[model samples]
Target: MRRVTAIVPALLAALMLVVVPAVNARADLLGGKMTLRDENKMGHDFDQILRAQQNMVGDTYITDYVAEVVARVVTGKRPMPFHVKSAVIANPLINAFAIPGGYIYIFTGLIQSVDTESQLAGVIAHELAHVSQRHVVSRIEKQKKVTLLSTAGMLAGLLLGIAAGGGNAAQAGQALVIGSQGAATAAMLHYSQDDEREADHVGLNSLVAAGYNPEGMPQTFEIMLKNKWYDNSSSMPSYLSTHPGTAERITYLNDRIARMPKEFLERKDDNTRLKRVQALIRSRMSPANTALAYWDDMKQSDYTPMDWVGRGITLERLKRLDEAQTAFEKALSLAKDDPLVVREAGIFYFKSGQADRALGLLQKASIMNKDDAMALFYLARLQAEAKQYGEAARNMRKVNELVPEDWEVHHHLGMILGESGDVFGGNLHLAYAAVYSMRLDKAREYLKRANELAQTQEQKDQVRELEDAIQARAQIGK
Candidate 1:
C-alpha cells in the first residue's frame, strides 16, 4: 500500500514527514474521498514501515500517558471518522507529527520541552484538527498529478532521516524537489497558510472544550519559537525550517485568548502527570550530560519529587554513585509513596547491589503502578536472582505481555521461564528476543530449539505463530 501524508504542528513550523510509503502500489485517489477502511489499511502499512525503521517507545507507562491525553482532546471535538491513537517516539527532536487514519506521534524531546500538560495537549489538538479537517487529503487531491515516486521518495527520505536511515533518501528527495516537481510536492505535503489558520481556530476551541487553558495553544508555539530548533535547519527538514507566519499566528492566538472569560483563562492545568512523565523521559531516555545539566539548572526550590529522581538518574549515568544516592534519598524523603520515585530509586539500588533494600521498594512500586512494565521487570528480576523462579517467571511474563517487542524483556522472561521448567516457553521467548534484537541467525536457532521441545499441539501452534512473525519482521527490513 502506497499512500502516506505529512504530519505536524503547523503552529510550530511547516508540516514534517511522518510517513512516506515505500511500496509500489498507486495512491488511493479512489474517486470521491478516501474511505475510512482505505486510510486504516494505509496507516497500518505506514506503521509497519516506521517500525521496520525506528524504535517507537515500547514503554507502556509513557505511551499510555500520551494516549490518555489524546483521548481527552478527542472528547471535546466533533465526532471523528477515525480513531485517534498516540505513539510516543524515542526521538530527541522537539516535534510531533500525525499520519493518516489518526496516528499521532510526539518526540521525547517535545515532552521534555513543554512546561505543562496543556501545552502538549494544545499541539495535539492542532494536529487533530488537521486530521478532522482533512487538510492533507484535500491538498493531495489538488496535487495528485505530481510524480508519485519523487514525492514518496522525498517524504520517505525526509522522515527517514529523523527516524534512523542516513539522509540518502532525503538528499535524493531534495534533489528531486530542486527539479520541476518541487512546487507541486511542497504544496501537496504542507498545509496552506489558510489551512494552518483554520486548524488554529478549530484546535483552540477543542483545547478549551477539553477543559484546558486557551493560552496553552499559543504558549506552546512561543516555546517552539524560542527553541533553537527554529534556527537549526539540519535539526529538522528544510520545509519545516521556515516558519514565517509564526509571530503573526501567535499574535492572533493571544488576541483571542484575551477575549475569553477571566476565570476561564485562569483555569490551571494539572502538571502533576506531565511532570512525572517528563521526569521519567529525561532521566531514562535523554543524553546523560544534557539531562544532568537540565536538572542541575533548575532551582532547588522548583525541583519536584520526580525532578530529584531525574537528577539521581543522570548522576548515576555519569557514575556519580554517591551523589546519585543522595539525590534518590532526598526524593524518597519528599515523596516516599510515589510510584515513579519508588520504582526508579529501587532500580538504582538494585543495580548498586543493595538488592535487599531494593526488593521491598520495587515490590511496593509494582503493586502501586501495576501498569508500569519497568517496575514489574525489576521486581521480576529481583525475584529471579533470589531463586524465586515461580514468582519471577509469573512477573516477567506480565512484563513481556506489556512490552512484547522489547528484546531485553523477552530475553529475561525467557531465562526466567527456563528456570521455572518451561523449556518450550523459554525457547519461544528467546527466539522472540533474538528477532526483536535483529539477531536473525540466533532467532532461527532458538526457533528450531523451541519446535523440538514443543510436545503439545498448543506449543507447536505457538512456535508456528512466532515463525510467521519473524518472517513478517524480516520482510519489513527488506
Candidate 2:
C-alpha cells in the first residue's frame, strides 16, 4: 500500500523482514495447505480474524487508493490475487505493511508524507514485491520450528517502535533465548546491502515496467532525506527514524539515477495529474489543509476525471452534500465514459436515498465495468433495503463472489435470505455475517459446525450465543 507519510513509531526495523514470501513456499509454510481454493479459504479465515481491527481503524479511502495505484502500475505483468484486501490502521505514523494472504495496512501518517504520485507508487511497488514474492508466509513458517518471540510481543514492539524505545535489545534477547531469530533478524531484514540493492534495482525496474517514471524512487528517497533536517525538531515526526536513513542508501540512489539513459533522466513529472490528485487528498485533510491543497491545484489546470472524483469524494466526506453533488455531476460531465466516476455518482445517489436513481446509475456503471464490486454491492444493498430479496441476494452473492473478504456482503446476504424466508441459508450466512461483524450471538447460530471446527475455547464460546439466537429466531417464525 502507498504509505501515508507522517510521524510514526519506527517499527519497520522489526517489520521489514516479515514481508511477502516466495509463491512456491506458500502452501508449505502454512502446513498442508490446499489449492487455490484453499488459499482463498485461508484468506477468508484471516480476513475474518482482522475484520474487527479493520472496522475500528476506519478511513478505508487510503486502502482503496493504494490498491488501485499498485494494481494500475502492475496491471499486466503481475496478477493480483483476486481478494487483495487493504485497510488503514488509523495511526498518525508513516508505516505500511502486508500480512500473509494479502492483508495490507497503511498508516495515515504515511499518506501525509509523500508529495508525488511516483513516490507513492514506489512504496506500493515495494509492498507488492513483498506480496508477489510471498515473504511473510515464509517467515511465519520458519518461525514455527523456532518459536520466536510471541506474535503478541512482536506486535507490541512493531506498534511501539522497539528500536527507538530501546526495546529492540530486549526483544532480540527474547528472540535468542527462544532460539527464535525473528525480531532480532527483523531489524536487519532490510536486504543485506545486496538485498537492498536488488530491491532497489527490481523496484525501479518494476516502476518503469509499470509505466511510471523510475525517478520517483530516487525522488522519494530524496524527499525522505529532507525530513532529516527536521529531525529532533518539534515538527519532526518519528517515521524518519523508523524508515532509518543511511547516507549509503541515498548515495546509491544518486549514483543509480546518474546511470540512467539521458532521455530517461530528463523525463518530465506528471505535475498536472499529481497536483489534482493532491488537491483531492488535501480536501480530505483538515479544512485549512484542504484549502491549501485546493489553492495548489488551482495553479494547475490539468485536472482529470479522477481529480473531480477525488474532490467529490472529499466533499461528501466533509458532509458538504450540495457541493459534493455538484462535484460529482461535474466529474460525470468531464468523464462520462469513466465508470469510476459514474459509480461514485451512483453511490451518492444511493446514500442520498434516491434508490431508483442510484440503481439506474449503478447498473449503468456496472455495465460499463462488469467487475466493479462497489457498484454491484451498493446496487444490491439498495435492493435489499427495498425488500427485493431475490435480486438483492443475487447481486450480494456476486459481490461476495467477487470480493469474499468483504464480510459485510455476507452479513447483508444473510439478512436478505432470512427476510426472504430461506431460514437455513439465511442462518448460515447470518453465522458468517456475525463472524465477520464480530457479533457473538449471531455467530454462534451459524457455528454448529464451527463448534467442532474451532480449536480455541474462545471460538467455541463465540458460537454458543449465535446458536441460541438462531433457534429463537426460527421459533418466532414457527
Candidate 3:
C-alpha cells in the first residue's frame, strides 16, 4: 500500500508531463491569474499532499513555539493581509520552505541546527519574506505559458521525490520535471539570485523589527555554511542545492549585519523558552540511543533542568525506568516550579506506574498553562484510569478544544464520552477522529451512528455537515 501511495505522485507527474504542452513553447497559452486567493488555493492543495506524505509533528508545545516565532516575524503593528500558518516536519534534513500562500514548513533538523530562537526566527522570516514579497506568484506570472495545475503537479512530484530520498523515486521525480528541459525545471524549482537577495534583505529587517538581533540572520547563514563544509556535496542539504549562491548570500548578510545599529545588534535576554523548545525537539525527535549518547557527550556543567528533562525522556524511551525517574527527579528538584518540567516529570511518573504522582504533577502543569493540551490529555487518561468518567470526559473535551485536529485525542475523548453516556457527542467526535486520520469508511460509519443518535435538529445538521466534508475529502483522495 505504501509503495502504491509513493508511486501515485510520480505517475501523476508523468501523465501531466505527457499531456500538457511544453510551457516554453506555448506562448499563446492563457496563464492563470496569480491572485492572492489563487495562491492560497495552490498552497492549500500542496499542504494537503505534503501532510499526507510527511510525518508532521503534532506536539502542541513544539508547534506553538514555532508559531510564536513566525508570529513575531510576520505580525507587527500592521496586520498581515493573509493568515499565516506553520507546521514542523519530522524530517531530519536541515531545511525550511514556504509555499505560495502563508504556509511555511520547518524541519526538525533545522530546529536542531540552531542554537538560539532568534536564529530559528531568521530562517522563518526568510521564508515568510518569500511569501509576503509574492516571489512565487511573480515567478508563476513570468511563466505565462504554463498552466497552474500542471506546474503544481510537477513541482509537488519533484519535491516529494526529493523528500522520499530513494534512488528510484528521485530519478522518477527528476525525469518527470526535467523532461527535455532540465535547465527550465531547475529554474522553476528555485528563485532567481535577485529574488534570493531581496528575501534576505526584507527578512533581515523583519527579524530586527521583531526585536531579534540582526546578527542572527548572518549567524544562521554561517551555520548553514559550516554544515555544508562538513557534508559532501552529494549529501548537501536540499536547502543549499535549491537555494543557489549561498557563499554570496553569506557575504551579503554579514556586510548588512555590520552596518546595523548598535542597539539593534544587542541580544535579547529571554532565551530560556528557546532552550526549552530545543530540548523538547532533541528529546522527542532523536532516536533514544542517539539522544542518550548526545546527553552523555555533553559536559555536566552545561546541563540545566531542561537538559535533564530531555535526558529523562530519552531514558524513558530506552526503557531505563529507574534512571529515567532519577533524571526526572533531578529536573524537578532543579526547577520544581516550572510547568514544562512538571509536565515531563508527570509523564515519566505515569509511564513508571506512579499514577498518583503523575496526577498531581499533571494537574499542576495544567493549572499553570490551560492551553497545554499534552498535560490535559495525560490528566484525562489518569482520570479515566481512576474510573472518574465524568471528570475524564471533561478533561478530554478540553484537550480536544486545544488540539482539534489531533486524531488520537479525539479518539480517546470519544471513548471517554461514550463510556460517560454522551452517545451523540461520542459518535460525532469518533467520526471527526476517523476523518482526520483518513479512515473514510470508519468516519462514515461513525457519522451514520451520530446521525441516528441526534436528538435535536441542530445535531442532525452537524452530522450532515460532517458527512458532506467526508465526501469532499473522499473525492480529493481519488
Best by TM-score: 3
Q: What TM-score quantifies how close candidate 2 is to the native fold?
A: 0.64
Query: With candidate 1 superimposed using the best TM-score fit, by how many Å does residue 174's alpha carbon deviate from the native?
Result: 6.1
What lDDT does candidate 2 reach at residue 145?
A: 36
Per-residue lDDT for 260-376 in model 1, tens only?
989868889788888888887877777788789897788989888888999998898789999999999999999999888898899999988899989999999999989888788
TM-score (all chains, Cα) for each model:
0.83, 0.64, 0.85
* Rank ordering of all candidates by TM-score, starting from the highest: 3, 1, 2
lDDT of 2 by residue, 225-245 (tens): 677576443224443453444
- What does each candidate score in C-alpha RMSD? 5.3, 9.1, 5.1
Model 2: per-residue Cα lDDT at residue 324: 71
| lDDT, ranked from best to worst | 3, 1, 2
- Candidate with better TM-score, 1 vs 2: 1
The 10 consecutive residues of candidate 1 with the worst lDDT sum are 1-10
Tell me which residue pairs clash in candidate 1: none
Better of 1 and 3 by lDDT: 3
RMSD of 2: 9.1
TM-score result, candidate 3: 0.85
Cα displacement (Å) at residue 93, model 1: 1.4
Evaluated with lDDT, which candidate comes out highest?
A: 3
